[model samples]
Target: MDILMIVPASLLVFILGASIGSFINVVVYRLPAGLSVLWPPSRCPHCLNQLKAYDNVPVLGWLWLRGRCRYCKNKIAARYPVVEAVTGIIFVLVFLLFKVSILTIGYWAFCSWLLALSLIDLDTMTLPNQLTQSGLVLGLIFQIVIGFFPEGSSVGAIKHLMMGIVGAVLGLWLFDAIALLGSIALGKTAMGAGDAKLAAMMGAWLGWKYLLLAGFMACAVGALVGGVAIALSQRRFGQKIPFGPFLALGAAIALFGGEAILSVYQGLFFPVT
Candidate 1:
């Protein structure tokens, strides 16, 4: 691609992605709270004042307003701008990777949904069925439809989709088992149902093998982070910690880097081919 083409495309991705991220923020905040995403225009959480168009302009609006509600002057959470900026950055990266391919579009959609679910799970310690179950089903259906499409000559595509289904089921069951074992061992619930559902959703996108990789990464990261937290806080063991966010981070990593990780693993351990 020419430099001019690249520049324009990059700008478009940044602008559009940030705008979509603003809507995603609404989804994350409202869906868990049982508020309708479409109906009832954007409003201040504190004053319930309906936001004007100018007030809803993604990160710019937040910056312009100094992170306060226009009507109520209540301080808005910094998370809004951060989320928008993060999503915009992710959009640019994905565009660079796939360069207008359908895969880029699919992953973009997937990431937006996951971002909302991850934040909600972090805040509420509960994954709304709407996000978890709906994502699971939708991800599977997307894979199935894509896998069976066009000439149907690509047996590999079909295999991938089947693997996704198998992976989803196995991931769900494995998480359930782990949760059960953790509950019994700890005398308390260690994992939430939402975490299992999110894993299934990831499996639907990444296939069972990648899902396993994701689980391993999640466990490793969670252990490291939890240990650090314990040491920093000087807290005793058995303290409650949310696992869903760590799982989400792992899932994102697996989604983007699973093939690379697998390549490294194979090079170091398998090395035959």
Candidate 2:
């Protein structure tokens, strides 16, 4: 399709991603506090005033208002708009790769939850069970539903669902075992319980092979980052760094091309591994 012809479609996708990112901001704040995300509308964090519709228009709203609350004129964190923009970019990139398909929509939902969990983990140093558990279920649902679409086959749907189940089980088991073994080896807490759940969620969505690839990627990246933190003296040698962000990045990469990346690694990149 011509780029001009898909302009409207692309715009719609961007808008959808940005809007969801705004909602993810709410979930990140409220979910950890045991607060209802849907009960209250968007409000100014400083003033507690309900935001007007125009003020809640994601990135544009923040830009229009100069990143300030309309009621109290308090400066808003630039992270809000940055989150919205990043989400829009992620969605656009995924769309460009996969176009419109059941699997693409599944990837969108997967990425959406992944972003929410990652931001929440960054803020709290903990991952909420709400997102990780729900993600596991949603992943299975996507596989099943995608299989039963009008153009899809029931047998294929069942097969995918079974594979999804295996992936989920292996994901949960593998990560949890890693955490347990690491803790025993290090004589301290090595990984949070939530990290295992997160791995399970990714496995449910992407299958076991991709999930393993993501795990490898996460560990390599996390080690590099943790090393940098220690060397910079920003973190103590034994200090714990939240691993969710690294895992989320790995999952996103796997969603795009885990197999190709694995091939590259096996062929010309990291032959020793």
Candidate 3:
């Protein structure tokens, strides 16, 4: 694409992502409460006033309103605009990396879901099955469609599909095994089923190798965060902390840089045959 076209296309993608981020705020709020995401148009939580279209215009609206509800002057959380901005940034980054393609769309969808799930898990310590299960199904469907493309023969397509399936199964089993062992060691439940499902969803999208990389990254980051929390007296040792955010973060890293990182690791440790 020409530089002129790239600029406009990037802007469009960013706007699109920010708009979806707005919808994601709703999903994050409603899904946890078991409320219908469609019903009850966007409203101010404090004053229960329905927001006008101008009030809901993603990051721009927040800035224009000075992060306060127009009706009640209630302060809006900074997270709203932060989410919007981050989503826009990530969308632009993805476009830069993948350009325009079905894979880009798929990754965008995956990233959006991961962002929502991470925030929800951070807030409630629950990774809702609604998102994870649906995402798993969608990932499989995406792989199936991609498998049929001319990039590979029919046999290779079948193999690719099988890898995705096996990845999902292995991801679930890996997390479950960790959960079970942790429970035995701690004498209580350590990780929830939702996390396992989340791993499975990621595996379906990322395949087994990247899934393993994501798992390792999640563990390393989770441990660091946990240690910091403990050191700051924010959390007691053995207190439950949500792992989904770390998993989501890891999956994102894997999505963006896993191949390069794996190549470097292999070069260092395994070397070329």
Candidate 4:
């Protein structure tokens, strides 16, 4: 692509991603509360004043307002801009990786929901079953549709979809069992139920091959990050740590880079250790 075309295309993708991220913010905030996401316009959570059109213009609006509500001047959560920026970056990467394919769209859609669920779980330590169930259906549809396309074969897409469903169930049940066992062993719950549900969502979307990969990656990342934080803070062992964000990260990676990762892993550890 020409330099001029590249800049324009990149800017467009970034804007679109940020716009979607704005909608995702609504879903994240309201879905758990059973609120109508579309009915009410965006408003100040502090003052409940309906936002003007300018206020809803993704990242630019937040930057213009200096991250404060125009009416109430309440400090808006910095997460708004952060989510938008992150989504924009991810979109640009997706465009590069898939180049106008349905794979791009499907993964983007998956990430949108995952973004909401990750944030909600971060805040409340709960994963809504509705989101996970919906994601499973969507992932199945995406797999079958993509399989039919010329580049890939649809011959076994259904089988993969079944594997995904089974992976989801197994992931959730295994986590639950571990939680139960740890509870019995330690006299307290060792993991949050929300973590199990979120893993199920990952399994549903990624299928067994990538779902297990994601689970391992998520656990590894969570341990490394959480360990560093605990060590720096001098926190006690077994302190509560949020696991949803790591799971989301893992799922995103699996969806986008699973094949490459598997190739690398096979190169390193092939011949069945």
Cα lDDT tens digits for candidate 4, 1-273: 777787889889999999999988888898888998897899999999999898889888898899899988989888998898888888888887887788889888888878888889887777788887788778778767766675566576766667767878877887788779988987887888877887777777777788888888888998899888888986667777667888898888887899999999998889465
- Between candidates 1 and 4, the lDDT winner: 1
The best candidate by lDDT is 3
lDDT of each: 0.84, 0.90, 0.92, 0.83
* Per-candidate TM-score against the hidden true structure: 0.93, 0.94, 0.96, 0.90
Give the lDDT of residue 167 in candidate 1. 79
| Cα displacement (Å) at residue 112, model 1 | 1.2
lDDT of 3: 0.92
Give per-residue CA lDDT, model 1, range 99-202, as digits (tens).
87767887788788778887887788777788777777777766766676655646756776787789789889999999999999999987888788888888
Give me the runs in candidate 2 sitting further than 4 Å from their true place: 266-273
Clashing pairs in 4: none
Root-mean-square deviation per candidate = 1.8, 2.5, 1.4, 2.5
Ranking by TM-score: 3, 2, 1, 4
Q: Lowest summed lDDT over 10 consecutive residues: which window, candidate 1? A: 148-157
Candidate No. with top TM-score: 3
Better of 1 and 2 by TM-score: 2
* lDDT sort, best first: 3, 2, 1, 4
Worst 10 residues of 3 by lDDT: 148-157
Global fold similarity of model 3 (TM-score): 0.96
